[model samples]
Target: MVAVALAGGLFTAASGCAAEPPSPRERLIQDLKTEPQFKDYSDKQVECLADAYIKYAKPEAIELIMQGKTPADSGWKDGVDGRTLTRDLAACNGPIAPSPTG
Candidate 1:
């Protein structure tokens, strides 16, 4: 019985550690909803920001944005003005990345 209980605990711990992290899209929404600065953004605004970040920012920049850091001056390029992108995202102005075919 002791060995069985110990094995069960080990399995639980291992599974807990192995739990998958949230995908970028999920993380972006979570950040927008949970971060004090971004909490007031509408759902559409949050979606835009998430889409823009997923399409533009590098991993480090994404982490920073998730932490409530502004993207301006972060040196993360999106092929659009940083401030404009942020404003557009806040306004839900279609942050979808442009197609490469253009």
Candidate 2:
């Protein structure tokens, strides 16, 4: 009986220790929130920017940004077409979309 109770406790503890990692979108939002340039942005603005980035930016660009590279970086810029990305993200300009100007 005591062994059973101990095993149950251990199982419960182990289960609680496992936590799901944040999704890519969530990570983008967190990255934006931490950026000095976005310091003044509201949560809603951050979410909108993250959504726009995911939808319009190239996968490589998104990956680079998530890895802490600025859009101005040569590798990051190579992955993004500024005009097209900016145009596609225009509707999300409620708080000014992220610029490839970096």
lDDT of each: 0.72, 0.75
> For residues 1-102, what per-residue lDDT tens digits would candidate 1 score against the true structure?
999999999999988896688898988787778867666666876787788777666777787766767656754664657786677555564434565876
Best-fitting candidate, measured by lDDT? 2
In model 1, which residue pairs have backbone atoms overlapping below 3 Å?
none
> What TM-score would candidate 2 get against the native?
0.59
Please list the residue runs of candidate 2 whose C-alpha ends up more than 4 Å from where it truly belongs after superposition: 2-17, 70-102
* Cα RMSD (angstroms) for every candidate in the order listed: 7.9, 7.4
Please give, for residues 7-72, the per-residue lDDT of candidate 2 as tens digits. Answer: 999999998896899888998999988999888877877888888777666667787877877665
Q: Quote the RMSD, in angstroms, for model 2.
A: 7.4
